[model samples]
Target: MRVGVLTGGGDCPGLNAVIRAVTKSLIGQGQCEVMGIEDGFQGLMEASPRVRELTWDQVSGILHRGGTILGTSNSANPLRDDATKALVSRNAKALGLDVLVVIGGDGTMSLAHGLADVGLHCVGVPKTIDNDIAHCERSFGFDTAVATVTDALHRIESTANSHHRVMIVETMGRHAGWIALEAGLAGGADIIVLPEIDYDIAAIALRCRERELRQRYTIICIGEGAKESGASLTVRERVEGSPDPVRLGGVAHVLRERLQPHLKSEVRATVLGHLQRGGDPTPFDRVLATRFGHRAAQLVLAREWGRMVTLQHGEIGSVALGDVANAQRTVPLDHELITTALDIGISLGR
Candidate 1:
């Protein structure tokens, strides 16, 4: 059977590894053809859709690389409506593919489900920086981002300590704070703030002062989506005809502004921005991506439709797509581990 594949939404480390694995495995069978779609659903919607042929050599030497050859766009999802769905359906048939493999986080996987509802045969592989894909212990690129953020925090630590100031470092995470939690803990951040818990800034400022009393410098790691309990800090900007509106960032600036007057202490903010996503894959991510890619190919060969490749309890496995899209996986603010951090007098900004 011939298979078609696409990587959608944000680009992550190990995407190339998955492509290489799929190509190598399919080629080994001697009876399968694997094709790639470009730029997510938008590529599939073009009038005369084009595809990249997967030859073994094309995928070689990319096992440890970051990003994908197929490219990605968070704004693209082709199965949203009749017109776009028809386009994708026509393109898939035109390419003569038997099944489709989609690698992405929630939005991309949800697009696969939508296409399936209209008679498209597909499977998914979860990919997200948030590490919030349900039933999956972890996803590819997460380790890499964690390492990146941790390193950044480490670099910022000495400066904050030397100056005896509060340093707020912002990392990526929309509705979950796994990145902030892991990186902050690893970087020895005095305070770690996440969206999972409603924040009390005044209490956090007090803790910062206490840290100052003891250590004289405070380093706080906060997720971009982190918000205080009373009001959201996002500033809505007008977009034309978007089905869902965009929620933009400013949390770091807002948090700094709020803390400045309360503490009367020197406060600074450093936004990591896209630096987290713009580097080489960490060793962990490289190995994990290779494994996920190789296993994804095996799953395709076995015809496990509607299952997403996932890492659970240190094992490579699969989970039903429905479970993946149901809701986000989040870290409990008062979890045993969280309490442990609290016991050590870490400020969670709550």
Candidate 2:
């Protein structure tokens, strides 16, 4: 069987590891041929699609790399129109691919499901730094992001302490607060705000004022999707031709602006934009991505088309692509982590 592989949606740290594992595992079999689909599903829509054969040598030395060698485009969605879908199907058939191994987040999985609807077989591997994919307890790239955010917070805390000021750090999380919540606790943040919980600026200011009585400085970690009480999410901008276009950002700056009036110390805002996305994958992500990739290849060999590899409760498994397509997993309000933070005297901006 011939298989095509592509990385889609926002590029993450473990993408190269997954690509490397998939190519090596399949090519080693000798019975299966692996092909690389360039620029994601957009490649399959082209009249002369961008592609290449994946040999063992081509995938060598990429396990510790940061991004996909095959390239990716988040803005291009091949399932946007009927003509585009037909073109994609025709191109995939012309390429002689029996199945596609799609590596991506929710948007890319949705595209894979659409391609399956058009009679093209696909297997999915979840890839997202946000760790918001449904049915999967953990996704690759999230560990690296959390590490980056935590490191940044540690650095920011020193500066805030030196200046005796309030510092707000914003992290990437459009709908879920896993990055902000986990990194905040790990970095020793005094306060944390998430999209799941509405934040009261006055309450945050009260905490900052109380801290000024003792520590004289406060560190706040907030998700990009977090909002003030009775207010909508802060949007950076909107992309015209993408599946999920509402860009969430600037909540830390919003928090700084609202909190400055109530606190005596100067307030500052820092946005860890894309710093969480770039850089090499952590050791945990490397192993997890490899496991997910090998599992996906197993599914392909077992003829488990229309399924996505998942990691749930420490087990590697598979779920239907239809079950995960366009689905999102957000942080629960009663999560143990939330309870831990509260019990540790961390303010949640409630």
Q: Looking at candidate 1, what is the lDDT of residue 323? A: 72
Candidate 1's C-alpha runs over 4 A off are 233-245, 334-336
For residues 320-342, write the lDDT of model 2, one tens digit per residue: 99899889999999999999999
lDDT tens digits, residues 199-299, model 1?
89888899888877888888999988788888875543534332224655668878999898878569999988677776667777777776777777777
Worst 10 residues of 2 by lDDT: 23-32
| Stretch of 10 with least lDDT, candidate 1 | 236-245
| Structural RMSD, model 1 | 1.8
Candidate 2 TM-score, true structure as reference: 0.99
Tell me the whole-model lDDT of each prediction, alpha carbons only. 0.80, 0.92
274: Cα error in model 1, Å: 1.2
